[model samples]
Target: MATFALIHGAGDAGWYWHLVEAELRGRGHDTVAPDLPCDDDAAGLVEYADAVVRAVGDRTGNLVVVGQSLGGFTAPLVCERVPATLLVLVAPMIPAPGEAVTDYFANTGYDEEPGGDTIAVFYQDVPPALAAAAVEHGRHQSEARLGEPSPLTTWPGVPTRVVLGRDDRLFPPQYLRRVTHDRLGITPDEIDSGHTPALSRPRELAALLDSYVEAVARV
Candidate 1:
């Protein structure tokens, strides 16, 4: 069974992947969703990747590292440290080497895009109760690392995939398409959900992830 290293986004905890974890576990795969030190004033992307590596320990087998949103910045770092078999980015803030996280918006022209209400952007498709719980589960995302450049000098050699939320408003589909292609020369696979698909469409999300494993095994 492959071990899925699930990394959450900015201000989010491991709980963000609970539903997806349950689904994966039920399908006979192991998953690790480590709570990043997002609230710590001293912790940055390196520390975030360290948490995931520590959680992984010595487990051996296919290692699929999945990162969401801001976690995108840390996922490749993990792949660089570990023998990751696949790197999957879910509605990610795909980063450039040496680019500060804070500069991503302006660099990608996200700042020029039309904006939406926070809730409407992130949780429009998520159920109200679960979305509320997601909000409560959020922590204070420290700005300590916002100005630090991403440490990845080049993309990891591991196979990579990008998944896009078709209805996402925070990073709209069109925007993500442009960014993904521009940065990675790849077209993302689209899903019929908003930004937080783990909460809004766990089963579908899990199935998609599972399919990747199957596809990789054939290679």
Candidate 2:
């Protein structure tokens, strides 16, 4: 069984992965979902990567690291420090060298203006009850962390995959496809969900992850 280290997006905690973690565990895989110190003024990408590395401590097995949204910036750093078999990015923010998350929006042609409705952007495909709970439990993300430049000069050597939410209003599939091709040089696989699929479509997400792992093993 592979150990899956799941990293959540901005303003989110490890609790966001509860559903997906349970699903993976049911499928007999070990999982680690660490709460990132995104709100801490002192924590940046290095600190985030350190947290993930600590969570995966001393595990010996095939390991898969999955990052969602802003967690994408941290995942590769973890892979650089550890030996991950695969790195999967879910509706992720692909950061260029020396580019901060704030700069990534305009660089990728993503809408940088604020004031969009959260429900329309993130919860469109999620269940109402769960989405409501997520909004209520959400914490503030630190600008210091988001504004910091990524430490990576190159992508990690680990095999990588990108999973795009087909209906994601925040990062639409077409936009993700273009960005993934240009940045990661791969075509992303699509899923039928919105941005928060771990909470909204855990079973499907888990199955997709399992398929990716099996496919990677064959190669």
User: Count of backbone clashes for each model?
Assistant: 0, 0
Candidate 2 per-residue C-alpha lDDT over 1-219 given as tens digits, one digit per residue, 9 for 90 to 100: 889999999998898899999999998899999999988989899999999999999874789999999998988889899989999999899878778888998899886342368776888777889888888867789987677778888888999999999888888888899999999898998889989899889999999998888998899
lDDT of each: 0.91, 0.89
Predicted structure 1, TM vs. truth: 0.96
Clashing pairs in 2: none
| Candidate 2 RMSD to the correct structure | 1.5
TM-score of 2: 0.95
The TM-score values for the models, in the order shown, are 0.96, 0.95
Model 2 ranges with Cα > 4 A deviation: 112-116
Provide C-alpha RMSD values for all models, in order. 1.2, 1.5
* Local accuracy of candidate 1 as per-residue lDDT tens digits, 20-102: 99999999999999999999999988899999999988764789999999999999999999998899999999999888899
